[model samples]
Target chain A: MHAFYSPQLTISCREVQLPASESRHALQVLRLGVGDRILLLNGHGIRAEAVLDAVDNRRHSTTTCRILQADAAPQPQPHITLFIAPPKSKNIDAVIRTATELGAAAIVPVLCRFGVAKPDLDTIAHWTKTVIAAAKQSHNPWFPEIKAPAAFADVLEAADDHGFFGAVPEPADALPSPAALPVDDQRQTSLWIGPEGGFAPEELSALLAKGLQPLTVGQWILRVETAVPALLAVVLDRCQPHQRETAE
Target chain B: MHAFYSPQLTISCREVQLPASESRHALQVLRLGVGDRILLLNGHGIRAEAVLDAVDNRRHSTTTCRILQADAAPQPQPHITLFIAPPKSKNIDAVIRTATELGAAAIVPVLCRFGVAKPDLDTIAHWTKTVIAAAKQSHNPWFPEIKAPAAFADVLEAADDHGFFGAVPEPADALPSPAALPVDDQRQTSLWIGPEGGFAPEELSALLAKGLQPLTVGQWILRVETAVPALLAVVLDRCQPHQRETAE
Candidate 1:
């Protein structure tokens, strides 16, 4: 079944109206009419089945649907929070979309010393839209919370959870792999990936002082967009056994 | 030092000439002149430091440089070959780039039943360029060998190594996480990711019949570009200990 984002949808509500944007897509593009079954996602782990009751293609078109069934998906364990410094505008979009699809619980944009692009209000809003679209496309019920861009220091101070920094390994040193990290279900795990030029010396020192372990994805230096998904995948894989144990 | 691709570069060559494309980039774009030091990558694990011997900016421009130092990086262990069904043109680029950055030894585009786009000669050539560029940007000395697009059956027949198929888990079935798979350094690891709609029923059956274990990246359905990196990171993480052991 085709899934559409309906943020206002709730299990308690007998009938739900698709948002204007979704309505236009369903009516004009998908041509979904009365009695057509579709899945509704509310960006809160809710996947509700609904049947279209009314469809209007007017300027203020509204596609209304009656709820048939609703279920909340269990969120992925060891909530992954990605703190990334934005790359170029286009690359940042790829990072956001890929991070969302990879099941990041939250994405926080951090301003780093070597970052090329500074995030603004408009950029943050655009990132949120990208995250939502990614979720809808991936059929992920939960939308990753997109945090406003903040300074590296502020982000470090706020990172109270168990954290790992994705660092490019030095010539002779092999940074610890994520697989070597201990898996703990009780604590949330956060990963911080720096800009293309990497974290400045002071920033690296600060991260080490804050007890964030450095994890290397590979020998090569990965771009911000590449590193985000790469690091998340490794972290998620390391946390899988813990997830299975908790489930049982 | 900045790195440029010099496909003809070798340690024995006292002086090497950069290709016209690299020459334009070095002389015209970067404005590097004679005696400037730069690193050269041969996209086969060779990194040579060289000093510019001659700089020409004409239409058939070629920058000649004398090799100062050379070293070949050891190829990454457990060669990873990715057989992915082509996504949309733009997304396929992202997938190829990320896969290269994550250190896939080779990439093969496979045509799947549900694939959106068919790969042509032009697309294959474009993918090769993307891989080489990604290697340069990521500072990887080795560029992944980009194979011509092949049919699903041909790829399956050639995939005799240990293989994993990225599959969406059935509601009640728990697909093996990539981390849970046993890691062996003796065999190459190949991953097959389907297009957006995923592999058809017969494709899945064929994969299973060929003994490709199904591995799920996450609960959510991810885009091809997103899944490529995510799957690779997990596989690489799982294979890390083995790599270290082999290195030692």
Candidate 2:
């Protein structure tokens, strides 16, 4: 069934009205009409099955849906926070969407010594909308938070979670050996990605002092955008035990 | 250091003439002339530091780089093979490029029940060039083979190694329990990605007989392109330790 996102939804209400945006989507774009069945999911994680009651041409042009069923969503696993140096706008947008789809709990953009792209408040607000849009599309229970920019030092200073830093250093000083892969405790984890030029020598020095695990992703160097998603994929895959069970 | 790829290099000679393509790139595109320093890599896993000895503007330009040092690269572990459901042209190209950067050994285009896109041999040939370009840019030790199109069944029939399938299934057959993560081994591992429409019920049924691992990348559904890189990142990270560690 086609689903829609309407934050203005009320719980236990028999009659639900679509927001103007959703109203236009159902009536004009998707052409859903009275008695047509659809699903509505609020950004807060409520899923509802309903039938369209009517489309109001006036009063913000609401479209009412009669609820057939409503239920609470189950909880997701250990949280993931991306404390990355911002890339260009396009790549950041791609990262936000994919990370949200992949179940990242929060995304915190941090400033690094080599950081190149700096997003303004308007850009940050746009990204927040991207997260909301992605959460809706992926049916995720919670959208990842898009935090304001911060100094790289602040990222390491405030860290208490199991932390990761995407870096390649002298082999001897590399990450805690893979044998010491994080134990499956299901606690929230953090991933830090550098910019196109990657972390400068002194910045890396500071991050390591704060207990950030300097890990290498693969043999080749990945771009800023690719690095973020690749790290998320690897970290989340390692952390989620339920995912491992599927392999026979 | 800037790296350039040339297939015409001979392994034992320790000296090589730039290929026609590299010659043009060196002389014309980059406008480099004699006495400039450059790095040349043989797509066959050898690196040479050479100087631009000479360049001819007329009748097939030529250049030379003397070997400062050379080493054989250790092969990537778990020998990844990406069996991606064919996506739109641009998306497919992006998937191939990103997967190669992530160290996939081969990229096999999969034809599945839910796959809506198909390409001719000419198109496949073009994508092959895309992967080669990506490999050079990433400076990856190995280049991924772009395999011909195969139905999901054919791909599985030819998959002599372990297989993991990405599919959405009912709760009764939810992916293997979380504890069964595959043990890292010095073996090739193959991954199956669903098409945009996803695997049909019957396609997944085929997996049951083959005992294919129906693992989910995570809780949410990823677009076909995102799935390719995300899945590779997770699987390859698990695969590295068990690989035969031949020191480069």
Candidate 3:
């Protein structure tokens, strides 16, 4: 079913207007007309089946829908907050979108010493849109809270005991054992991924000082976009081993 | 350090010529000079440190490098072969690239009942480039074998008992249990993911009849690109829980 983002959607509301962008997409791109049924997402936990009721065509058109039914799903557990240095331009979008699809509870773009991209307000805004589209596409009920790009120092200040960073395994060193991770816990967990060149020594030291442990998926050094989903999958698996078997 | 793909690289080879594409990339894009040091990957398991010795700048310039030292890594275990019905144009590149980065042993493009994008020779050629580039970018010593797109029935016939397909779980059904998967085995494993609409019912039945199991990685219906890496990570984690702790 076609889906649209309607932040104000609620079960009690009889009618709702799709967000301006969503409305334009529905009319111009999807060519959805009145009387068509579509899914409305609130970026919260609301999923409402709504039928297009009115289309006011002018210089700026608006599409309104009547809600038939709505359901709220409790957010998934082990809320994961990802703190990552924004990768280069080509990868930033995929990174954000995939992280959302993987159900990251929040995403914090960090400006690191070795990082390439310094995301601006516009970049953040674009990422917000990417998150919304990803949520609708993946049918994720809960949208991740997207934070403004923060400095590395600021990120370290916010780091807590529940935080961990993806470590590149050393050849002579032992592999990161699964026992090192806290499993079967629903507490909010944080994952910090460094820039392409990786976090500087002082940055690593700072993260470690803040009680962030190191976790490694495997031997191969993966690009930022590749690492995000891979690491998230592993961490999520560890967080709720048995809960993911059934459909949400 | 800059890296290049040299398919014929071996430990005994004293000198090697960079492939035409690599030569152009090193010269035009990367701007590496005659004395620059680089790492050469054979796409098998050979990793060699080499120094550029000569730059034959003719119509098609060829770069010759002197092999300094070489090290060979054994191929990673639980070799995963991905049989995927290609997604739309935008996502296909990411799917192939991320699968290679996740250390898929081979990738087979399958034409499914609900699948879009019937890939031709040109697309296959482009995907081969994508795999090679991903291998080099991810610093993966081993390259995944890329095969020509095949029909669904042909893929089903080639699939073994070790195969599993991602199932969209029913809300009321019990979640997929980890115990259902065969863990800690080094044998080759196969993962088949359908197109955006997923496999038709009869196609699923055919797979089931062929002894392919259904595996669910949580409830979120992921995009093909996102699902590829997420499922690969989970399966790889299960394959050798302890083996991935250290770097190769």
Candidate 4:
């Protein structure tokens, strides 16, 4: 069954009327016909069984999906937020899309001391669309919340509630242990990663002061994009294993 | 300190000259003049401090570097081998490069039952180049070895001596744990990851007959690239927590 993401179903029936973009994909690209079965996710860990009611392939790139029946809801997925010093435009776009597929709950673009890329609100909107589309592709019910690009201090202030930073640490220092971050009750987590040249020395000191962790996956040097997923793999590993095995 | 990789350092050192390609990178791209200091890593994790003596920028892409004084040897880095079903070319590139940065000892391209993209020898060469390039960039003394791509059963005979396979058990069954793998002397370890579509039922059965386990990382549907690094993160987490702590 094909899967779609529609977060609009936060309420009863949790029905998702496929958005124009998704409809185009399902109808035109996938050529999925009406009455065909498909799955819809809200990025909230809910899986809904929806049938294609109508595919208006003309002007409206929307697929009217009728609720057939909802499947047994998955256990609450981990809430992971990413705090990254947004790299160049295309790079950040790639980060958002891939991060969503890997199950990040939110992405906060940070303007760190050494950060080289900072796009305006319009650009952020475009990035937000890219992330939404990715979530839809993965059929992830919970669409990761994309925060408007924020300054370094704002991120620091939010550190206690929904923030954590990632950096390479001194040889003798230890990263936060696996036990340090747990997923017993769905506590939201934010992971911060820096840019190419890395966060400035002062930025490192500031982030460290604000309780950011200089996490390390291994001894080798990793590109910024590689770091995010590698870090998530570590973070996600700490969470309980996958709940239900899906059919291939 | 800047680090470079020089695989040829078995014997002489009176006037150690860096490879031509490295010389160009140091002298041209990085613009390190004579009398400048840098560290050259002889792919076993030994980093030697060298001063630029005669950088005759004779050729555009190749310059010469003569070693200066004391040979500074960093600790020998561990070797991690990833025997993975070659994913798409791009994803394989990601794996080799990222794995190298993450301190993989070597990479063995294994053609498994579900292997989708069968990379030819030329493609294999390209991937090996990627690993080499990543080693230089990550500043790893351990040049991850790229074994010639081979058949799946061939692996049983030559399973890296310290290798482990990542397998998730069928529903209701849990995969065997890493504790099962032998850890005699931390020799080269090969980690096997199935294709994105996962292993064939028959393949899984055959491997089970052997004592080797299809170790499962967790429950989530991890992409091929994601699975290797995540498991490596854990393996790196286990055998080299001391190193991860230091690398941070």
Candidate 5:
């Protein structure tokens, strides 16, 4: 079934009108019309089943649907929040989309010593579309909240709960491995990834001083795009085994 | 250090001449001259440290280096071979790059009922560049072998060793979850990912009948690019805890 993001959707509402962009997509691209059943997401926990009730195709088209049933999915366990230093290119969009698909709780763009991207309010608004599209494609009810870009030091100061960063495999490293981080399903997990050249020595020291452990995936140096998904997948898998089994 | 792919590199060689492409990149892009040290990879297991000895920048530029030291990196443990149905778009290139970075043993593009890409000799040659580029960037000494495209049944018949495919989460599913797959670091591992929309019912049944187990990352349906890296990172982490610890 086709899915549309309706942030204002509430279980109490019987009728819903899709946003202008989504309405255009439904009518022109998907060719959806009256009487068609579709899924509606509130970008939180609510996923509602709805049937199209009206299609007002005028200068600015609108499509309204009648709610049939709304199911609220529990937030994913070991909720993951990604604090990443956005790359200097469009790869940040790919990173955001993948993070949403994998069910991250939030995304924070950090400005690091080597980082080049200076994301603003406009950037957050632009990335919000990418998150919604990925959630819709992956059929995920929850959307990751994108926050305003912050300084690296500010991110470190604000970080809370068991956090880990991808450590470049270097000899003489004394930091604890990811396996050493106790997996507590009840606690929120935070992942910090640096820019292309990775975190500087002082930045690393600051993170370690803040008690964030280091994790290594292999010997190779993975780019931000690859490292984010890889680390997110592994960390999420390890942290939520019990929840997954219970769901099964 | 700048790295170049020299498929024929051997430890026994005292001097080596780079391929035309590598020479052009080193001379023009990197602006390297005599006395500069670089790394050379054979795409199998050999990585050599070399110093530039001669630069013949005539009509056809040539770069020769004196081998300083050559080390053979042991192949990644729990050798992973990704037998994937190539997606219709450029995402296949991304898949190959990620697989190479994570140290897969080989990549075999399989033809399935829903698969759209018909990879020919030209396609294989094109993908090889992506593998080399990723390996060079990631500093991975080992490059995965890219084989000719094969039919779905042929892949099943030729498959040997413990295998797992990502299972779509569905109701009334009797298939075993990924956790059920026992970890054996000594065995070669194979992963099969279907194209967009997933495999047909018969294709899934055939895989199950052949004793291939199913793995699940999460409830969301991940695209091939995201799914491949996610599954690879998780499975590789689970399968080779011993090796990682030993390396550390």
Candidate 6:
């Protein structure tokens, strides 16, 4: 079934109206009409089966969907918090979407010493929309909390769990593969990926001082967008068994 | 130092002329003049340092560079062959680039029942160039051999090595995580990822009959571009220890 984002949807509400954008997609793009079944996600773990009750094709169309069933999805365990320095324009969207698909619990954009883009409020809003669209497409019930840009030091101070920073390690300091990292089921895990130029020396020192272990995903240097998903995949793979056990 | 693709480069060559595209990039984009040093790769494990001897600035400019040093990078171990059904226009470039960065030994475009695009000679040429550029950027000496699009059944018939196909497994038949898969250092590993619509029922049956284990990178569905890197990262992580041991 096709899924649509309906942020205000709740179990108590038997009827809901999809947002204008989503309504157009359901009506025009997907050709969904009255009595057509679809799934609805509120980005807060609530997923519902809904049938289109009324379709309005006006410029400001709002489709009313009647809820048939509602259920809460189990939240991802070993909650992953990704601290990333935003790359250039479209690449940031790629990072956000891929991170969402990989089940990141939250995404924090950190401002690093050598970071490329300084994201504005509008950019953050745009990214939030991107995350929501990705969540609906991937059937992810929970959407990652997209935090505003924060200073590297501020983010480091706020990080209180097991933290790993992505960097190409020097030969002598090569870290173990993610699979070999000690699995800690109790604590949440967070990954930090720097921008194209990488973290400056002082920033690296600050991360080390804050007890973030350095991680090398692969030998070759990766673009920021590529590294985000690559690192997340490795981290998620390491945390999968624990998640499965917890789910059981 | 910057790296440029020099497809015909050899160890015995004392001096070489850069391709038109590379020359334009070196002179106009990077503004490198005579006496500038750069690295060159032949996309076949040979990497060389070269000093620009003469640079022409005209539209059809070709720069001459003298080789200063040359070395062969060892090929990646447990060579990976990726058979992916081509996605839409630009995403095909992304798949090839990420596959190159992750050290795939060969990339074969397979035509599937649900595949969207039929790649022609020009598409293949474009994808090959994308791999070359990615190889240079990632400092990978071994460029994956890009093959013409082949029939899905033909690929299945030719597959003899250990094979894994990317698919979201049924809950009752969940496959082991890539990291948990038994490791065999002697055998080359191959992975097959279907197009956006996913493998048809018969295609999945054929893959399973040929003993290709189903593999899921994460819980959520992923786009083709995202899935390529995510899957590669997991596979490379599983293959890392053997690669390190081989390096030693």
TM-score winner: 5
TM per candidate comes to: 0.93, 0.89, 0.91, 0.83, 0.94, 0.92
Higher-TM-score candidate of 4 and 5: 5
When 1 and 2 are scored with lDDT, the better candidate is 1
Which segments of candidate 2 are over 4 A away from where they belong? A56-61, A169-185, A242-248, B26-33, B57-62, B169-175, B178-186, B242-248
Alpha-carbon shift of residue A69 in model 6 (angstroms): 1.5
Q: What is the TM-score of chain B alone in each candidate?
A: 0.91, 0.85, 0.90, 0.81, 0.92, 0.90
- Which of candidates 1 and 3 is the stronger one according to TM-score? 1
- CAPRI-style class, candidate 5: medium
Model 6 - which docking category?
A: acceptable
DockQ of 1: 0.51
Model 1 Cα lDDT, one tens digit per residue, B48-140: 999999876566387899999898888986588999888899888989888878889998889889888888888888888898788888878
- For model 2, residues B1-248, the per-residue Cα lDDT tens digits are 55677675545555678877778877888888778877666666666666766678675467766666666666777787888788888788888889878888888888987787787999989987787777777777477888889888888777754767766523465445423334643367777787875787777777656766666666776776567767777666666662213110
Give the TM-score comparing model 1 with the true structure, all chains together: 0.93
Model 3: lDDT of residue A97: 83
TM-score of 5: 0.94
Candidate 5 regions exceeding 4 Å error are A171-174, A242-248, B242-248
Once fitted onto the true fold, the runs of candidate 6 whose alpha carbons sit more than 4 angstroms away are A169-179, A185-187, A242-248, B58-60, B169-179, B185-187, B242-248
Pull out the clashing pairs in model 3. A175-B245, A175-B246, A245-B175, A245-B176, A246-B175
Q: What is the alpha-carbon lDDT for the whole of candidate 6?
A: 0.81
Per-candidate interface DockQ score? 0.51, 0.47, 0.45, 0.36, 0.50, 0.44
Per-residue CA lDDT of candidate 2, range A1-248, in tens? Answer: 66777665556767788877878877877777788998777766677888998877554368988898887665556677888888888889888988888878778888877888878899899998888777767766566778888888876788654767787523355445432234554457778888876788888777777766666667886766567677787777766654333321
Model 4 C-alpha lDDT per residue in residues A14-80, reported as the tens digit of each score = 3467877778878888899889888877656666788888778675587888887775445435667
By TM-score, how accurate is candidate 3?
0.91
**lDDT against the true structure, each candidate:** 0.81, 0.72, 0.80, 0.67, 0.83, 0.81
Best by lDDT: 5
Interface RMSD of each: 4.8, 5.1, 5.5, 7.5, 4.7, 5.4
Which regions in candidate 3 have their CA more than 4 angstroms from the true location?
A58-60, A169-180, A243-248, B58-60, B169-180, B184-186, B243-248
